[model samples]
Target: MNFIKVYTLTALFSAFTLIQATHANAITAPPLETQVKQVAQWFTGLFDNSQQVATNPSIPLITLSSCSVALTNTNPVTGTENIYLEQKSINRFRLYSFSQENSAVNLSIRAFDTNYSVTGLCNRPESEHTLDSSKVLATSCNLQLLWEPTDYIGNNSPNGCPTSSGGKVISSVTVSENGIDSLDKIFGANGNLLFATPIEFRRVDSIPEPSFTLGILAIGFWGTSKTILRKHKQKSTVSEESLFNCD
Candidate 1:
């Protein structure tokens, strides 16, 4: 009877451990590459269509430039969307949520002008799309962005901006590349979290400052000059010794 009881207790402990492990796997965040790819795929299609429209004399051309992600945060459902101009000026594009009406949604924008801190959540549209399960979840994981070229992001008013239909509600926000740079939580429906973090997106077309490249070249030239000088000095010394020995 004693042996049977001990075996039963051990089996119970093992079962508990297995159950916890399975739960953890379910909540575990997906890989950063996967997350970035998902975000990119969505935007790639959107941008392609937008760019074509922009070329049309009657429509605006919106091109996506760059994006990044953060790897850690307690909740991965929220973060900032940094917008860049023609691969030049960086700023926050105004945000609109696409979640169920009164489904406890929180959205905000932060511009680098004020250290890229979230200024405030834009006025809520009367109606918005509730995020389907396909979107991401959990914050401390991967964050992604799909950019649209904006000659005038503030005024151009992209087609997907928030509207009475809840245009682009943030289904899941991720901070996968860098941790929260800054945060400010405010009250919202269903005790939802309302906060903003500073994020940056470097444009690929933007010309890089030359100081770093120039410094590397300067060091290489200096080292070559020293090597030549040392060889010359050694040759002169050897010649002098030969002359003194009167070979």
Candidate 2:
């Protein structure tokens, strides 16, 4: 009996330890690429800054031209797929290029200004639907951007990007399905805050095509009419049965 008890106790302890280890792993497991993909969807739409700029005078009056997230074939050498974040403005354009590396994401940002005809080149053919190197006059910065939860936070690489604006910039952006909030700061060479902007952008709703909207309305009306007819048929059947029973 004592040997039996000892064996059972050992089995229970082993099971308990296994369970604890599995629970710990589940809690501490690194985020998957799918999670990042879902988060990217939140940023994949056109956002307008007009209302935000109007409400907050401190923020810059720059407009947000577009924000998009898509899968691209960028690195032919490695043959690895990557998620691309393209953000464009009136005067500046930025691309956050990222790929899943093991359990984490490796991200980098490339910035361009109006001097480089980025917008035009992006529309041109044979550019792989990417930036055209021939038209690019100069690249402003190439820095590593870090990802956390729903945010991408990073600063300019060490003396990597010298902006014509005369300061190093640090960017912190919080993104969601509804809108985006950004706190962008530029510090002078002396480490003093030269400029700061807190901007909010709201997502623009895509208007459905008139034909699609009409089709949906027609389907709804048809379903409603069918339901009404069904009820009317049931009522008529019940009245007919009553008359027959009275006879």
Deviation in Å, model 2, residue 53 alpha carbon = 2.8
> How many clashes (backbone N, Cα, C below 3 Å) per candidate?
29, 0
Q: Candidate 2, residues 128-150: lDDT per residue as tens digits?
A: 44444333323433323345544
Pick by TM-score: which candidate is best? 2
Clashing pairs in 2: none
Quantify all predictions' global Cα lDDT against the true fold: 0.23, 0.40
Number of the top-ranking candidate, with lDDT as the measure: 2
TM-score per model over all chains: 0.20, 0.50
